[model samples]
Target: MTASALTFDEVRQARVALVGPPNSGKTTLFNTLTGGRQKTANYPGVTVERKSGRLRTPVGRSIELLDLPGSYSLRARSPDEAITRDVVLGRQEWEALPDAMVCVTDATNLGQHLRLFLELRQLGRPLILVLNMMDLAQKRGYQISIEALSRSLGIPVVTTVAMHKNGVQDLLDQIDTLLNQASVTGDGTVTTDAWVEPTPEAIRGYHQEAERLLREAVIEEGVPEQLTRKLDQVLLHPVAGPLILLGILFLMFQAVFSWAEAPMDWIDGGIASLQQWLAAHMQDGLLKSLLVDGIIAGVGGVVIFLPQILILFLFILLLEDFGYMARAAFLMDRLMSAVGLNGRAFIPLLSSFACAIPGIMAARTIAHPLDRLVTILIAPLMTCSARLPVYVLLISAFIPATTVWGGIGLQGLVMFGLYATGIIGALVVAGVLRLTVLRGGRQPLLMELPSYKWPNPANVLLGLLERARIFMRRIGTVILSVLVILWFLSTFPAPPQGATEPDIYYSFAGMIGRGLEPLLAPVGFNWQIAIALVPGLAAREVAVAALGTVYSLSGSEDAVTESLAATLAHDWTLATALALLAWYVFAPQCLATLAAVRRETNSWRWPAFMFIYLMILAYIAAFITYRVALALGGG
Candidate 1:
């Protein structure tokens, strides 16, 4: 079992942890090392994500690389930081201590970052210091004496531009060397007294030592942060920043429609061709009905929007990598403070745009209980990607595709409006909650603004690919399952002989929709829409599939051949389409989101309250929209 004598398989079992301060390029390093060989899950009994990957070294030995949550110190303040602390100290339940540590730091901000490195050194583990963003450091004219740094830090040091393919080879070789040595040296025993929470004086001492180390081992050649400051002058301006942010968002929505149109059309055509081939080749029976009406129609309707969803994620990933996300939080702090929320809550809320589940979980980063609760309550209103399918369907069916303001497509304009409505709703709800049940003064937003960098193509592509995989998986699993059940419900208990109405009229789903239609009538929802809403509780996108399935089962042969959008355009009024759109903007329809709220809050009461209030809002919004649109001759 000796380190030097161990085989490659034993080396493969070695676990190394990557730790760093927030925005220190640690994640970029992890991604570069691991590529697609990664798995994400939650640690035992905690909501913080556990990200680990298998990394094969240049020497052909593999090791498990754990990407721990970012932390500034071992004295953890938030749940995320606590996980990092526990894992590093071998206190996390069901998780083995890492064999070695890789402390990644922003090369340009080594003074502040080195403080954490000093603390990790006290743990008495085999540690390597990775100065990531070395390319950026070099551009800014930083001169670091690596030999002196390693001598002073008493550890091996390496520089990396983690976004590049070749940037991490040296770090990998260094890791292999460290693990090889640690195996022979015996387990690096951690001192029990090493991790006592440093007092204010001790903290100041650490800061002083870090500064001294920097002065002796590092030198700056040119004006530091010159480019960052120049860019921030415009991007961080009080007036221009918010305006620019809005313009970027507006453009993103515009691209979601304009850029993805061709791909969406291709997908639509492919689905139509598949349906046609099935109809022409297969014998007409229960199995044909299930395949054509249930699976293809349901899943295909949602799958067509994949291009648009990917476009949306592309914009988000690019902005995030460019470091404007923190600046966005900074810009929104004024308005966030006005609503009695810490600006830090903006990150979680922004994440909600992708999905409310992670958005709610992201709230664990907020320190104040009341603030975090309010954030969790309103996150679902942030217009997640789940709602995109429904929105696109209704908009394409009811709204004219003509251009407005000369070049902007009316559809994209309306899409932007829907996103704006969700944001406004979330802010209003947050304000009300803070004024009432969750009353509390807002905490000041104290966060780092890393220097902006070019978006890494590899990182962006990986993110987009991951999102696409998740969306497709959902279609294959949840949406497919729901569609089959819906098909059975809408097809079973065959219609009476010589029945005049469609066969689904006598089915169970029809009965259920009819039962709920009376209550939904005021909001302009028909029986078909009512049926869709029931399964939509499982996922917002499933509503799209539900509609496709319901319509395919209940419509004529000609209607079944038409796209869901065309069929809806022929049957529904503009008022109903607008009302449904309004409903989705407010409805807490996704059960996964509510479950996330419960888990994050550790109680059912908040989730119950969230559900009630959101349902009320959806109803009222739909009612008002229906009435107003009807008055405007959209009925």
Candidate 2:
């Protein structure tokens, strides 16, 4: 048999699965092999993340690499682990049995990692074991007999650093060789049996076998590593650790405001120039109004905040890569336990800070159903990147740009306060829910902390690039369509002849806003603000763009050159601005978030409850903020 004799499916594209435990550096290797050419979404009927990429081998063969979610065992517990177990055993409807598997394991924790490896070998796939972070293992004085490990496991073993480009060539070569073997011989190299659920006795037997193998293959040469211990003395102190976590979070939010200033100015200037050119060149028609006010002003208003978003993502990726995120989760465990939840809930809530969808998806990692439900319910309370534009816009307009506390910017401090408010709100909601609707026994936090290392620059860049693409994609589709529809509403039913007010005052949007004005007015929102809230239900950031489009069209002709921030500051009272900010802090601003909640819970009951509670919270918070501001003579 030869390579030329294989079928097209086997010859052209071979499906390979990358399986490993959490914090095992499996994703790092996937990124190395695929060069960030991966698509990340959810699998059918569940929110477990599906990540896959394509790679071309040296022999002109293409490989489809599936990066399975990190799991501890073949015995399914969480949805993430279930996905891994199902795909490998050919149980999933959408996935084929992988022709080959790359089982990555942390070199420093061979005892626990080998247990998973031994269980996976039962599938009898053409598997290759990758000992990632070999350099880190060597530095820690841990040694392993690679040849003996391979012999014991009856498979090929390779070592990879994963962060560097040259690290994965050996692993790739092994995959190519196994794939080639499958293509030519079509031997019993793949699992063909239906997955049988494991019994306790069988699981215990596998663990024993793993322990036996580890003793033979691994050699512990010295005392345990002291770097993490030395760092944790200060980092994990009861007083200092919490203080340090707060300081780190505060600094991260502050950097979102400070570091993004120059780039934001550049984007603002570019959008302004484009708007001016379009206004002057187009012949003052619907096209001109639509382009200048609807598209440019609407999309540009949100796009300008990309710098701030990227900065936030940069910090998150760096913290995650440097392994401090796990420590942060650990620090929050005690606080979480006090709230009647466990430390496992901390990560999902923390992840919710970036986006509720992922945060809700991340709840799948929690073992207990009640705990997962509570985490999902409170996830939206954490301010996501979408709310950054709303916060930055309101703060820049109302909060002075002056330095406070001897050096910090007042705007940044305000931004940090907004984030803290969200955190406090999430805790309160979780505490309430745990005591009421979802009360249950708390699970213990058991997680292995990865060794700290300098974040790989290439990985950071790729992470940022992926986030940028997501933002741009939203701007081009959902935002674009919403803006166009909003433009129509603000333009049509042509203003009554010789109307004294701006043209928008008589448009459909104005009528709709006025209809809701009485309801929202107590919170300091006028007709325009009310109108903006309608589009905001689609996405939180859209409210900023909606305001831009509404104000751009409503203002006098000279207002075209002014930024939205300046325009808002001139027209809106400080009381109204503060009210809006407070409202957003608890508001259910994204329908996508609600949809995610619905999918995660598999019911409309939870989503409806989520929306009602959040709305009540938003209204109360906004009313209080508005009343307090007025008392302080903010008007």
Candidate 3:
């Protein structure tokens, strides 16, 4: 079978795709081959990520390499699987059929991983089989015959330790060789009709054939995954596992506060210096005020939290790459099932800790519609990184920095409590929705637990860099744009000159905030808090920025130099601060998250219901918290 006739110089760039099952190290190979040359975006309409990169062969020929989503088969059980199938068959409107397919498999578990390769072979496209994690396989005493496997499968096979970039050149050389053969044969046309979804009987036959091939070409001299199994025995323990998981989380939250303090202080000091320099250099005018009070104070307030956000992501990335995330999900299965959720929901919900937008979109993996919807509705309640700024700010202001028993910081305990509250709230909401609105039979979680390995530093660093890039980009674009508009609203209509109150008291923002204050007053929100909440609808973290700008404008120049946390600590009562913290725990403040829900569900009704319910929850939670705090003498 010849490869697709598409030449390297054809139309734009010839494309090659990496196909594999999950945990096959396909993405690691993609990262190794592409280095920093990759770009990630969604496919034309679907939310499944489209990761493509430029790779130059040893012979100096360039091709676009696509890393398709991992799938066990082309059966299209989920949106990710559907995409893999459609793209492979040239079915997507925006994607053309690839000229060649590279099927990656875990070398240590070929018996299980070869089924997907057999399915891909039926497509008759030019194919290369990659035995990734070859080093690990060899260490485990698995002896694979490269030539025998190639001959049996009728394709070239390459060994790769993708994390270490070993034998990657051989894979590239083979790709060049295949493409050259296709060009000579002049049979580059891809044929999609050769492949079809296998029936149950055909699937069984494929499995049997895969096993036979493995028997002929492979020998196992030692117990497979012995170390992984030994570790799993303890890590997957019923009682000890949950306790360990909680301990890890408690430590993570505590680290978020402890590790981030120095860097956050540096950022705060830098922002204060910049504000002071601007106040000294620029004349007293709208321009100076905009640059100093509006832009610096507002944007800096959010940027200072970057260290904490990245610290949180660092932990998540490391856990995910180390393969512990799967175990955590397994540990939570019982609790999730009791709430009418599949254990699979844990991943999307875990992702919510980064951002609810992606979390909601990730629901496409859940096969059940009701299960997916319930996951989406409760995703916002999972304290995202955006809320970290708000939570940390309030905790720093109101919660004491004193140590408690076992050497834990009280501030971190409060932070952990807030996260725990969000989790409990999500469970309660999921249960209620399941029992009422979207009630349905629950689906059991069926997922693979990948072997544990040391996380690749390159991959973890790449992830952290991408996260930082996205965060800074948001501040430059969305946050910066909103702060400008907010500055205009808070600054204009020039204060009825000679009035005793601050200039902001008579501005457009002030009037609007005042108009809403009466309704929010019961929940402990003043006009400034009301003002902040309006722009906060764009993003939860923006509320911190909004408050900084509002308070900066509402007070003397010295306010711009003082930290927002310190300023809030002085002006806001403990009850109001606690209430605001309670409010954010349930507030559906991100419009992007709503838009994601709308896109995912293909309905306005779900998003609307989501918004209304979250708002009511936020207000009620805030009201109760405020009253309780006041009664406890926090007023």
Candidate 4:
């Protein structure tokens, strides 16, 4: 078990930089080495930065491992790649110099992967080559002689299958030997012909060295990978690829709608029962109102989204865990490119449909600066789950859930429309931004298509649970706090004594909403909607609960006993419902996304621009929707 040792009590510490070409299993290996204790962050100024973590090997050696962004070579075109190269060469503006480097390479495609291995050597970073993906190499009818290759490269080499944790022991054994000797023996005799500085004269020399090394020791399998080639037939063909992607996306959303309904209904029933029991027992006053209307309705509004969030995460997790996402990125790059967006933007945007925060965070993976910004800016436009509650509320209220086209439901039709609107908006926005603000010439997409595999069940469960936790946390903290204050505002200026029934109209809440009504009238937002928009700033889902309470208070105080579903079904006008749904498509509903823009862009200017532009667009869209529908007589 003493796999590697540089114990404080035993010898010198090791600073290791993990260098790998893109998708060479470096990140998965980092997660395995560091567990869940790592922090992810973008480098200052540039959107993509280095991600590093501290790892203690099994033998108690303290090793600081930096997971550099995947780059094709040390000659970097992006800031992220530059930082990774600088660190390996110990040229960074911060932190102590690294002691050694681990060059992670794909064993199956060594010809394409060893380019980075040679690039790292040019940085003069004392390096060890990790022949990762050996299991995959073996599967493709190839074998590697690790000791002979190590001798040939004149550097320590270890063959590892990082995904399965196989050969990791030997990899560590090599690291310990390399690090131990660097201390006592001054640069281990282990070295590589791969080691050469990248000068105008030497860059080709290093590449030639790699080509030479690849020829003698590495054998071409004589066939393209069968599984990859087969999948790519459907996954990469321009016509077939987009169709397949659309189909997968449709199934994903379809599952979100159907699979989550039963669980949502169960939760809704539970909340209703709890509210009823509390009302029956508690004294009739603010406390009861706070628990039933404020707490149960507000908290329940957000928690009901858990099943849907989990459902979305299920597809995302399966795609990623099965190694299909890389292919997805590759396949979609062409369509995305036509829109002046990077194909890599598609994956991040798809993540945005789940929640914009992670989508924004994932944009760090895009190497192009303008592409990262464009992706981050348009990411929130994707219909997030926050938009889901609003969509479900309106669609379920106005449209029937009955099956259509012998398969899809009418309610599902609205869901599909809402999602389509988001996609169209993202593409249009990316096109505009590319032409105007983050304008740049086209960039070719270069990415590896990982082979497909069955997704791991445990990984799927853990991912779903994590997503669910984030959703609940947002509800409990931000949404709950806002709801309590809304309850305070709406509950006050109690109906005057001897006033006619259903007297919320006479309260301070009505007066405030009525004052704001004229501004929103063109958008089909009634006085009650104007009232809800104040608190809806906290979350898109909260607006659903606001409608639940304000309408209950406005029309029939007795409606506290009825489900909001029943209330909405009976009261809302179809034109009004359609207009409101359109408005939410562009509403700046989540403050968190705005806050993220500030963090990502490092200026109040960009975030402010986001809010201002979205609100203006939302108003214009909503106004046209409302007026057209009203002219058609509320169809």
Per-model tally of clashing residue pairs: 0, 0, 2, 5
Model 3 score (lDDT): 0.84
Model 4 TM-score on a 0 to 1 scale:
0.83
Error of 4 at 355 (Å): 1.9
lDDT of each: 0.84, 0.82, 0.84, 0.74
Candidate 2 residue-wise lDDT, 1-635, digit = tens: 45565567656678999999988888788898998678877788887778899997766578899999898888777778889999988888788888888899988877778778878888777889999988888887888889998998889999999888888888877887888776667756445475576688887887799788878888774346688788888888989999999899879867977898899788878888888787778898898988987788777766876787788778878988988888888888887877777677776776577667667877898877787888898899888877977887788777998998899998988877887898888889889998888866776677767767788888799888877876677678767887788788879878787887666668887888779899999999988899888778777877876676567543422243237778889999999999999999999988767877888888899999999999999999999999999999998
Candidate 4 lDDT by residue in tens digits, 83-166: 776666556666456778898988877877777777666555477999887887887788566666777878888888776655
**Model 2 ranges off by over 4 Å:** 1-10, 139-143, 184-194, 219-223, 341-369, 384-419, 541-578, 595-605, 626-635
- Each model's TM-score, in the order given? 0.87, 0.88, 0.89, 0.83
Kindly report which residue stretches of model 3 are placed more than 4 angstroms away from their true locations once superposed.
1-12, 188-190, 193-195, 219-222, 354-369, 388-416, 544-577, 595-605, 627-635
lDDT of 1 by residue, 1-635 (tens): 33466585455578999999999988888898998898877776667779899977766677899999999988887788999999888889988788899999988888899999988888898899999889988987889988899998889999998888799889988988888888777765767335788899988988999999988888664348877788999999888988999898779767876898899778877877888899999999999989987788667767776787788778878988998888988888888988888888887887687677657877888867888889899999998877987887888888898998899999988988998999899889999999999986666566878878788888798878867876787578766786788788878899898987666667887788789999999999998899878778767877876676666533422244348888899999999999999999999888767877877777799999999999999999999999999999998
Task: Give residue 267's error in model 3 in angstroms.
Answer: 2.6
- Which prediction has more favorable TM-score, 1 or 3? 3
Best by TM-score: 3
